[model samples]
Target chain A: MKAKILYIEDNEQNLYLVTFILEKHGYEVCAATDGQEGIDMAARILPDLILLDIQLPRMDGYAVARHLRTNPNLATVPIVAVTSYAMAGDRDKALEAGCSGYIEKPINPDTFIQQVEQSLTKQEE
Target chain B: MIACLVKACMPPNITHLMGFFISLIRSASAYPFRNLSLFVVLILLCFEVPPARAEVRTVTVGVYENAPKVFTSETGKPSGIFIDIIEHIAKSERWKLRYVSGTWSEGLDRLAKGEIDLMPDVAYTADREKIFLFHKIPVLTVWSQVYARKGSRIQSILDLNGKRVAALDKTIQLETFTRLTNSFGLKIILVPVPDYKTEFTMIASGKADAGLTNRLYGLMYARKSGLEDTPVMFDPAPFYFAAGKNVSGKLPEIIDRHLSEMKINPQSVYYAAMKRWTSEEVQFKLPLWLQMLGLGLGVALVMSLAGGLILKYQVNARTGELKLINQEMEQRIDERTQALQVTNSKLQVALENLAVAKEHAEAADRMKSAFLATMSHELRTPLNSIIGFTGILLQGLGGAINEEQAKQLKMVKNSANHLLSLISDILDISKIESGQLSVFFESFNLKDSIFKVVQSVRPLAENKGLFLSVEVADDVEEFTGDVRRVEQILLNLLSNAVKFTQKGGVRVKCQRNAGNYVTSVTDSGIGINGKDIGGLFEPFHQIDTGLSRNYEGTGLGLSISKKLVELMDGTLQVDSSPGKGSTFTFTLPNVIDSV
Candidate 1:
């Protein structure tokens, strides 16, 4: 069975590219425009993994992660943070805020799924 | 002297006196009028009556401050040893002595104007004799001396030239000083003090460099003022009583007779004055250390003890040696400083030369690295993509292609691979030229390395339909070297053998040669010329022939292989002949395993 991933990104072109590359690599991609909607989708569908964005409207990724963690069904989902900013503490902040993994953006279509699948692999183990 | 006179003139001596007068008159009668006139004048002078009863012959004595000889007494009278002599003359000649006081030069002025009848203690020179009539007998023999600060080095009259000297303004030594200056053309400045004491004081206090005065007065004052004596006589002159040049009376002849009488009697006032004034004690300027030793002792005794013998034995030798040692030390310091400067400059030049060589080597390395970097990026980028995409296409990911099309594609891939190797060879040449080539030492399977190179080159051999083979000696498997570079060297030689041999077989042989691994590649092909063999392993050199154009390459294979082998601490060589087969051989050092 194909592993499913939840992608949270505000940029439309970035969302389309990651979705296209994931679909091409035979993985299912579900996405949201910002942090709150991403949390709602993660709770409702409880996708195989959540790919979160750090900067979003009304609620940031950290607050969204808190809101998502309150839903019992989404607790074990591997939350991967996909970020465009390469600030020094961003990776540790994402992991601390309940992300299973971190990916710096301008995402390469080639290694993008391998990184996402690595997070998904952790959930199975 | 008075007793002698009384004895000569008393009645017991009356006939004797008459006898002497008759002889004097007899000589006068024989000489006629001129002799009689001189005899009458002589008799009048010789037999003058006592001034206590007869008409007084008042003689004005001109006096001045000249210390022991002619200065005024503490009682304010014109009295000194010279005055005592004159008083004796007054009592004998029945003349009343009147005293006039002034400086010594002023005494001469007063005498010249006839204001005083007698000026006592004059240093008689021909110049002074023109102004006054000096007595026939001198009262004193005198010379001038210089007194100085204890450390001053004035020992000669010549040493005083251009020096500041002290002198009494009106004294006889001032006259002597002036005469000496004019005679020797000296340019000394004389600082005139009022009395002889201060003349020596000015030198002791450092106000003047030297002082000039009578030796007797200077000696007394030099002790009082802590001054040193130079013992250099300024000049000597006979000191005499002088009479007025205008005087034309019996007074002068009377005074001369009394002086003659007084000199003959030891009991005379003249002899008493000589005993009172003459010291005969002289002192020289002792060196400072000795003078310090004489601080409380009698200066006269110290001077007598220290005059010549003791000083000569001690001072000259020590001073000469000190001066010599000082000169030697100064010369050594100057020589050492000059030598140090020369060596310092030489070291500076050496440092500069090393810096220049280092800069040249560094700049060459930078240029080589920059050229290699650009080639790696710009040239390899397109070639990599072209080769990679071609590989993907031949894998049929897009679609299938016809055999003819695939053959053309295969040719493109082969040519691309060849071009890549040619570029790599050029880059390697630059690296070696700039001394930037690096190699690693490692141990690996030597036979496996050879067989790998053989496998890679076998298809090229098959394309030419040439038999290719390898023989590795039983003991030649594991070795030590930079494995990748060694492999590259083997591949270069194998590729060249396959490319050059068209009809005959190519063979690679590897063996252990007495602890070293030697590899040789032999080929049956159009062989190199014997003359061309020398240049075969130099970069960018190829032999020209009818078949040369048919081959396409940078002609860099054997050269890069040779240099790469050398970089691995090995040697590569070629043996060939025109139209005969050739062999390329190389030897690599082995890591000897311990038992």
Candidate 2:
């Protein structure tokens, strides 16, 4: 079975690139253009992993992350933050807000799928 | 006949005797038988008549008031010791004396002019001997004695200093007192009265401090007028009977003769006269204790006066010293005040400059941080898409691509990746400079991080046909530090090694030196000159400064890596020489606290 990933990002190009990369890797990709839609869609579809962008429109990725953590159904789901907010404590901030992993932006396409798989695998543990 | 003539020129007393005898004879002729013996005796006594009686000489005497000596008595008679002696001699000589009373000076002038035959009570000096004739004998010995009002301070000759003294004018007392005081270097004011009586009057009236009078007069009259005799006495000489030079030398000789005879007799008229006049002198004596008390009081007064003078001198000296000290202290205070004011102004200027510098530095840091934030997010967001899409095209996920197209796509992906690294390096250096960069401390396997960095840089080294290698010691196992930053520093060093090496190879070695990890990256392509290596770690500095620069880089990697290592309390150093390979080593303590 194909593991599903919910990609929450405001940049359409970033969403498209990530979707294409994950779909090519034989994983089903779901899209949410904003943090709230991502959180709502994440709860409805119950995706295998959530790839969150820290800087998002409407509800921010950290708030969405914290909100998703409160729901028992989405709480066990892996939430991975893929962000360009890479200065100093951004990774710790994402983790503190209930992210399972943090990946710096301008992600290397070759390693992007591996990182997503790692978060899903972590959730499985 | 001559015998009868001589007998007829005899004295009247003898002629009167003859007259009685002749009358008796005439009476006997009338009664001859009754008076016959008396007529015979009268005729015999006529031959014994004395020669003509000596002529009675008249002497004019000058008298002045000098009591107990020669002064006019209240009975209008010339009386005193001199008068009594002169009168007795006059009686024996059968001489008539004519008294002329006047002031002492007037009498002296009368005697000088020979208008008076004699002047009494004159003190003899060699100067007076030139003008008047003095008897060989002085009638009395006298000295000038000082008299003052009762309870006056004048007690001795020296005590007459600065006093106003009254003395008789044209007298031996005034002339001799002036001489005596001149010799003693004492100054006194002389009030010359006409007589001793006036001198006593002036002193009594408080016009003079003391008076000079002969002792005979002072002793006899000083007490009568409430004047006391002072112990100051000088110029003791005999008081003589002064005669006019033109007077018969016989008169003084006769006076001298009588005085000499009278002096020896002791019971003579001279003694009788002196006793009569000076007998009024009081003979009172003070008790012994009273005299001693007066002496003690005198000594005390003298000591106190000396002490007062000494104290005044010392006070004046101390006052002068105090004034000098006060002036010096004021000057020192003024100097200290000036120095303090200068220092205060300098400190104020320094504080102001420091405040301004701090303000400028803070503002610059704020701007840098803002730029770093913008570049980190805004630039990388677009870069994420470019690198991702280009990567997708190269992989042929959409459709199969020809070799040429695939090659172009690969180039496109490489260019994008390079651009991303440039942007990332700029953001990193900016964050470090602005002090916004921070490290996270986590336990990570040291060998794992080194291998990952080596794997990522291996592809680039292979593309350049350069060998890549890594050697981490067995002891360089799991350690505590910022895992991300450690990986970043190793990747930066490895990438630099791969980029600079043309052939040969690049090597990475990690070892545990005591408690620290020493990681070194050595490259065999082109080595840097020793001089150029010094500036190699400086930001934006590259060894290639030529028009045709060979290297493609932002020249920020090594500088950023050096700064990152230093942030974790580590040191990065480079060893290289021209035409030889370069080795870059870094030492980081295994346990660094993350910020």
Candidate 3:
């Protein structure tokens, strides 16, 4: 079976970009437009990895990370926070809120797959 | 003489005669012949002496115009100190005093001729002592003084030379004056007056320039007669109750006895008599030492009172001056306090204005930070899509593309990347200026960081056919610093080198020197002018505005690199010459002591 990923993002273009990139890499791409939908989908599908956008509507990525961590079904899954807040301390903030990894916004397509794979491999280890 | 004899001899003779009679009668029976003779003699003596005690002796006391001492009073009765004492004695002695009023000279003459039995106020003199008898105790002490007309210049005996001076006729004062002037060789003419009144009247009328008289009479009448008493005084004498030498009476002796008895007692009639007759100044008649002591005490009291008044005046003056000075000082203090208050108020206003300005600046800084954050998100979100889609297309992930289309798409992707980097540089400088940029420190390899930067720019250098070389000393291998920021600085320097050099080569050198990591990037390219070197590190500064078209750049790379190097406690410096090349070197401390 293909490794499953859930992408939580508010912007449709960011969601499409991440989905296309992950799908082309042979990972099954699942979509959630908001933090709450991402959490529900994460618990139900029990995805192999979660790609989270920090600036989400209604609920943010950090809250979604903490919520997803609380569900036993999704607790072991890796949650990676992708954010446009490239200023100091943003990565630490995302990771402290239960994200397993952090990536800055305007994601470089060249490194995005590698970063996600690193998180999945880290979770498996 | 007969009265004296009777008075002296009668009392004893009578007592002896009676006693002999009784004794003879009792012894007649035993010795008849001798007893008969004694008895007859006793009886005859008793019969011969009449009743002497039964008869009162009459005394004729002479009074005169001499006042206070003996003159008759206004009531027409003989009333004077002399009569007062004499009557007191007369009452006790059972004697009748007969008053014979006369002039002083007449009284003296009467007493001398035995017409008056006693005369009072007689100053004893050798000439009078021949004619009158005086007792041992004196009635009073008197002195003679010269009296002159009120405005006359006769103040002493020397002033009496060639001047007519009047004196009482036959008086001791007159006799003494005559002898005194004559002995001094003064040719003063003499005017004899009958009494003190006449002498004073002659001097007052200017008949004589001055006159000699007893002090008692002068003190009494000189001022009334418009006369001044001169200081020329003489003849201090004792006055007595006097009698004619031939007069047979014990009046002078009796007066002496009474006066002597009165003198011993302070509360006696003698003191009363002196007080009544003499002026108040002479009444108390204190001892000489007592008078001196009283005068001394009086002088001391007056002097102390004067000194106390002066001290009090000076103290008051000083206190007034002190009060004025204190008031002035208080006023100055008040003025100073007011000035300080004004300054304090001004300072408070300035402080308030500064606080308000600070608050406004802080608010504006907060808004700018918010705007930077929002721009980072908004600008990058669309760029994220463009770069992602273009990158996906260039990779032929969706479909195969022709070579020409792929080349054009690569160009578009390159332009998009430049735009993204421009946005990123703008964001970085903004973060630096806003003091929001922070570098993370870790143990990183210096050579690896430089190798990675050189690798990123290697393809660009190969496309331009420029030789790129890197030399990192063996000791410059590992350093504890911000790995990401170090790589960023190296990448900016290498890319700048590759971009500028069209034909020549670029070289990078890293070495450890003085506990610092010194890295230099040197390029051989179209050189920079000396004038442009100074502004090379300023943000958005370009060497040649026309060259900006030929070279696509953000114009912020060198400035960002310089600032980043400075943030790591390092220095960035450059050297260049026209038509030659430029060298940019920076040094970072090998060990960061503090963040």
Candidate 4:
């Protein structure tokens, strides 16, 4: 079965761009526009990997990562931090806040699909 | 008859003696010579009769006072060594003694005016010598001395410089002290104390530095007061009794003889009187120390009451001072408190104004974001149509058009492309303000991405008839960074160079900038003015907006480029001068090395 990917992003255009790249790689994509909904959707769908945006409404990507880590059912799921904040130490902050991997936003169509596949495969192993 | 008369003139006793003497001479010379001898004897006897006795003349002696040596004293009456000698002369030469009594000045004045015959015990000073015939006898030697403070340094008349010496009002000692002190150039303040005792007290109490008194008086005072002897005596001149210049002729002779005789008696009455007066045998009994202590305590109690009154005044003064200080402190506190309240109110007003400003800022932000979304959709839709249709047409989808028509179509396509870029820049700025813009990162070949940017802008450079060159430095084969943002920054710079320059070439260079790769685009274009360089990266800031009208793009390119560079953790810098072209550079960290 194709690996299920959950994408959390607030910007509609960015979400369209990311989903277009992920679907083209034969991955089933579930999108949540907010961080809390992303965590709830991740639990329900039991996605193989979650691509979470750091800046979102109501809940942020770090909070979602922490929420997913706390739930026994979703504890093992791999979460990737996707953000536009490319300042120094952002990656370490994301990782320290419970994301397994980090990605910058404005998705590169080819590279986005490859990175998501790599994260999902690594989770399975 | 002559012989009988001669015999009658002589006494019967003499005639009998003469007859016996005649019988003796007649026996020798015979009867003839015997008659002549008897006649000569009778003649010598008549001439030898004794003269009748004259009565004794009585000389009158007068004296004002029984002067010790010159007058005698008997039972407190005037009878002394002087009187005894004077009575002996009076008995020998027959003189009467007359006694008188008066004050010393009165007696001296009477003697000087010739009212009295003589005055004894007078010192014959030069002034007194002018009016009096003085006897040579100096019956007593009185020395002048200065009785000073105990352990005083004063020793002689010269040492009396700048010192206050006290003396009696009118006495022989006063004249002597003044004359001697004046001769020595000493400043003597002759204080007339009541007596010698008081004068000693003046010196001891420091009222006077020293006292000028007779040596005898000073010694007597010192002995009586039990004071230390600070005798400063010198220049012993003699004291003698003076008689009037026109006295009774024998009066001076009588005084002279009396004085001469009195000198023979060594223990004279004057010495006895002085010894009696100055004797230490009659000591005065003083009150006991306990009695003096009691009197001192009484005085101290009176002084303590006065001290208590002064202390009350001091306490009142201190209380007044403290009250003044407290009032001043309160005034200062009030002023500071008022100032603080005013500052607090001003801050409150400032905070309220800041809140209002923040609300407006947020609203403006929301409106900008909404407008950006609508504008983005509107602009991109038309741009897509234009670019899509032009692509088809240029690809010969409508059958090959003429070169002129194709060139025109391409021009239209470029204009549409520029408009789309302008709209995109605006949208990006709005998105950045609303915090919706995001950066994308990927592992990519840095050289490949730079080459692609050069290739894309090369067409425009060719269209502008300007040479465009890309020189990638050695050892920079691959780097991990955001390719899309770097491409955008490079394209904006290159496009501006192409748009502004009429002829000169444009060059793109990449070099290592510390830990980052610095990419610069230098253009020999119609260069930006030096003054406008700072505004170059601000949105809607164009040099001469009217000149920018000829250029077909909104002035948001550099601003959007700067924002995009910042989002990728880089710096965008520009260097330019008026008419000297421009260099736009930016730094991008090599992603692999950055981590």
Candidate 5:
């Protein structure tokens, strides 16, 4: 079965690019426009992996991470935080709030899929 | 026996005794001790029995048994201390002397009654002066002191606190002892004796536990009276001879005359008598051997100590000069060292502050890099899709783009690549400023790197319709340096050459000079003015502010290229003639090999 991924991103272009690429790689993708929608969709879908965007409207990625961690249904879902704001300590912040993996944006079309797979593998281990 | 005398002599506190008797009668069982005390008081009131008087003379003198001063001596002659003093006065004045012995109180009574002409050894008090004429000067010094029988337990004044303590009647000691015991809250029996001699005798015979007498007589006549040494001495009294106030006599004048004479003339009989009685105290003649030893040791000790002190003084004076000089030099050294330490600490603080400033600058530089990266990413994220999708369309992946659409897609791709290059230049400058741009050096073909750079820049020149060429010296091919940065330098110059030139050509030439490979780029375009040439190598500066919109750039190419050349241990320079031509030149050192 194709690994389903939930991408919680506020930017439409970023979401389109990520979703199009992820779909091209044969993974079922569910997109959310904001952090709350992402958390809501994540609980319902129970996707295999979640690509949480740190810069989001209404709620940020860490908040989404903690909310996702609370739901028993999404306990096994691996969260990978994607951030475009390249400040210091952004990765540690995302990881501290229950993100199993971290990736920086603008995401490389070449390695984004492999990085997601690797984070999924890491969560499995 | 002594306790009974003690009770008898103490003028019993009649009121306290009455209270005790009342309490005793109430008890009705303690009548024995009460009757005994009553009997003792009666005996003390009536027991004293005698009266004695003397005949008259030129100066009838009354002498009390004040022992050692006016007492019956061992020979029983009419002699005592005052008698001898009077004999000296009588001899001087050609007057006959008369002396008599009596108790102190009896003598005072007789003198007051004008029976005696003068009484000696009387302590002058304000109360006594009303009855007698006291002399201004004292004849002798006396002490009221406690004396005890040989081997008796009454050895000290405190021991006589509850014992019978005898003091001469009408003496200073009597009043003193009364006040002292009252002040001390001592329930002691104080006996008023007629004289010190009898007081001493009573103590010696154990009729009294302890009695006070003149300290000198207690010491002088102690062994004779079978008593031990005086234990407590107090209230030093000055005794003066007093004349009867009732008699208007020349006695005071005569007495003062002889007393003053005796004081001035040590050879007088008074001095002889004092010397005779107090001979035991005269130890002016020490043993001969001890005197000799003391003199020898004293002289030797003083001489050696003086010699040592003089030598030490001379040595200290000699060393003090050297010490002063050394102290001055050492002070100068210490001052200089302190100044140097201050400067060193200041420099250390400056260094620490510089390190902090450097850290802050580095942080700003990092932010700039991140800014550039984000800008590059943001600028490229759109470009990524534009260029990638365009490339895809041009490749006919979008199901056959027509030739016109393909041309537009290609143009879009090229613009995006240009934008990417500009972003990279900004990133590179940020890296150099932040000290993050690392150089990798290796032995590589210098000509090949330049050739590749030229080939890559050929399209920009061709697009501008400017001819570009490369020239290389055969010996300057292989060089040890960061070949990539060298190529980047060459590319920046070549691109600038093509970008600026409108109707002319660009050329690159390489040659070897002094272990360095020099590269130069020449352009025949709208050249920079000499004034503008200096600023041309600075990032984001342009000479053509004419609004002609002629050349396009972020103006970072030359600055980035200049820094890259410097990073490879090279120099970048330019020479330009306005509106005519320009040439950019740089050199990369061929790093030497240690192996």
Candidate 6:
């Protein structure tokens, strides 16, 4: 079965861009507009993988990752942080906060797909 | 005959002799015998005479203890200038001599009463002349003077006004003192001391303003007591020895012959004796050897010191002359050194100019490569779009699609327009580097320009779901400058902010700073690392090589902003930290007044 993905992002353009790339690759995608909703949706769907945007209204991506990690049912789910912050050490910070992978924005379509596939495969292992 | 008479009165043996003697007398007598006998008896009686009364001769001598001319010696011997003269006259005259030692009053008394033969030293006052006859020879002239304490304020007779004075009683000084006191209205305190020592001590102890005495005696007292000499205020009064009126008949011959002779021979027996008795002889001796030695050494030492001082002065003059020459040479060297330093600095400045030019040339070479790369990419984008759309059309991929197919084709036309904008940015940066881009300055509201920038970047921020806030500080009022360029700089910064900031917010602030209007764009987004800050404003220099592939840009925004700010006579500055945020600020001159 194809991996089920949960995408949490507040920016509509970025959400569209990420969903388009993932759906085109034959993955089932679920979306939330903010971090709180993302946390709620993840609990409900218990997706195979989760894609989180660091910058979110109401709640942030780091909070969502921590929430998913605490739930026993979704504890082992692979979470990828996607952000426009390309500063040094941003990826390490995201990973340290319980993300499986980090994707920098002005997103490269090809790299974004590759990283998402890799994070999903890592989860299987 | 008396002897015959006695014989007649005698016995019979003598009577027979007497009768025979009577008959001899009758035979020789045409003269009476009795008368002859009586005449003989008378001759005998006259020759037998009564004893003579002694001669009553008196000698007068004056005594005044304080007088220098006539004073009693320390040994109680009567000796002075006048004493000597009187002793000589007494010896020459062979008269009976007597000395009446008493006060001056007593001497005057005896001379007036004719009890004394002479007064040794008395000035002939009118009242005195009426009672006594003076000798032709004046014994001495004595100046009467005032004696005051050392450092006393009594410099002149005028200083004696209303001041107390002391004088010896029954002295000529007393008369003179009285007259001066009355004339000057001085309060004379006549202290009749027994001697000059008492009088001098009284003045020294501040008991009197001054004491009146003969000038000679005052000087003698000062010398004896080691007090300083003071001048006499009044004229000198001449004094003399005087004889009594009873002996006035012999005065002229005695005074003329004897006194005049003594005056001629002043250094004779009398004067020598007086000086010896008065101890004036001691003053004529030579000073002791120790005192002479001390004085000679002092003089020789002073002469040697003066010679040494002169030699030092000559050496100092020579040293000063050499120092002046050295200073002149040093000043010349200093001037030459300063000139050489100026030339060295000029050479350094020229070298720095060359180095800066080389850096710019290298930067231009990189920019040319970046520009060519951007140009090829920009041209290929539209060409690829156009070629794809045209190939699709040629293949009838949109066959019979009607209005929908044509509308979709117009979207490709919009994508082509976006590629044109990328080419435009490259061309603009090249124009800026070549010095071909110029700003058109005009008066405009600075806040309005900043608002335009915020509005232009707002859609992009919204697309990322990021809050965009614009704040104009109250101090930033309307200003005049190059509005279009200012807007362009602000737009570039806000665009960069929206591009990086995927969350949180982008803020544009406008404020007045110093003399300029400042605009700042802050983003809570992907911040530039500190290591990259230095190269942020260099054209075509981004933080990482792969940044261009991840984020879309020519990497010329900050360099363009900085150059544009400088052209407006402003400064562009950036502060950023990795993973935190970045703030970009630029200033424009406030040209409101000119507007």
Q: What is the TM-score of each candidate against the true structure?
A: 0.39, 0.58, 0.59, 0.42, 0.39, 0.31
lDDT of 2 by residue, B1-595 (tens): 4235635755554554443454455456568766766645655655554445445679999988988898877888888998998898887666789999999989999999999999988888888899999888888888879999999967678999999998888777788899999999999998888877888888889999998888888888888788998888888878888899988847778788678778878898889998998786785667789889888888888887788778877887888788888888888888888888888788888888888888878887787788777866798888888888878877788788899998888888888888888888888888888888888777889899889888888888888888887788888888887887888888887877777777899889999887788999999967888778878889988786761167788888899989888987899999986666889999988774221
Count steric clashes of candidate 4: 8
| Winning candidate number (lDDT) | 2
Question: Which pairs clash in model 1?
Answer: none
What shift in Å separates residue B148 of candidate 3 from its native position after superposition?
Answer: 27
Better of 3 and 6 by DockQ: 3
| Higher-lDDT candidate of 4 and 6 | 6
Residue B431, candidate 3: how far off, in angstroms? Answer: 2.6
Candidate 1 CAPRI grade: incorrect
Q: Which lDDT tens digits does candidate 1 get at residues B1-595?
A: 4334544655432333443354345556568787767656655755653344345568898877767787877889776688888887666555688888877667778899999988877777777779888777667787778888876888788888989987877555687678878788999887878767666667777889988777777655576677778868756767877888887665556566666667777998888987776664455668887777677566767776887657886788888898899889999988998999899899889889989988987887787666674664446545644554455446453369888877887787777777677767776777677666667666899888888889988988988899998999999877877777788899888877777787888989998777678899999988888778888887887778545587777877778788878876679988886566789999887855421
What stretches of model 3 exceed 4 Å from their correct place? B1-279, B282-333, B463-465, B474-478, B526-555, B590-595
Going through the candidates in the order shown, the clash numbers are: 0, 1, 0, 8, 0, 0
Model 3 residue B344 CA deviation (Å) reads 2.1
Global lDDT of each candidate: 0.75, 0.83, 0.81, 0.70, 0.75, 0.71
- What number of backbone clashes does candidate 3 have, counting pairs of residues 3 or more apart or in separate chains? 0
Consecutive 10-residue window with the lowest summed lDDT within model 4 chain B = B52-61
Candidate 4, residues B1-595: lDDT per residue as tens digits? 5545655766553443443343344444456576676657656755674433223433333343323333333464655333454455455444454556555566677777877665655666777879987777665676676777667776556777787877655567777677777787777666776555567777777888877665655555565554555546765666655677787555665456555544555684434554544454445665789768877997898789789878889988999999999999999999999999999999999999999899998888898788776767656654545664565556565478999989988887777766767676777777776877667677887888888888988987897788988888886767776677778888888888888888888999998866799999998877877778878888777789787778867788888889888888889998887677889898888777877
Preferred candidate (lDDT higher): 1 or 2: 2
> Per-residue CA lDDT of candidate 6, range B222-295, in tens?
55543444555675888877778786447545655565555557776656755654543234334678678878
| TM-score of the first chain of model 6 | 0.93
- What does the lDDT read for residue A35 in candidate 6? 79
Alpha-carbon runs more than 4 Å astray in model 5: A1-125, B1-364, B367-382, B395-403, B442-449, B474-483, B530-535, B543-549, B591-595
- Candidate 4 regions with alpha-carbon error over 4 angstroms: A1-125, B1-298, B382-412, B432-438, B511-515, B575-580
Predicted complex 5: DockQ: 0.06
Winner by TM-score between candidate 6 and candidate 2:
2
Q: How close is candidate 2 to the true structure, as a TM-score?
A: 0.58
Ranking by TM-score: 3, 2, 4, 5, 1, 6
RMSD of each: 25.6, 22.8, 18.5, 29.2, 22.3, 32.3
User: All models, DockQ values?
Assistant: 0.03, 0.60, 0.50, 0.02, 0.06, 0.01
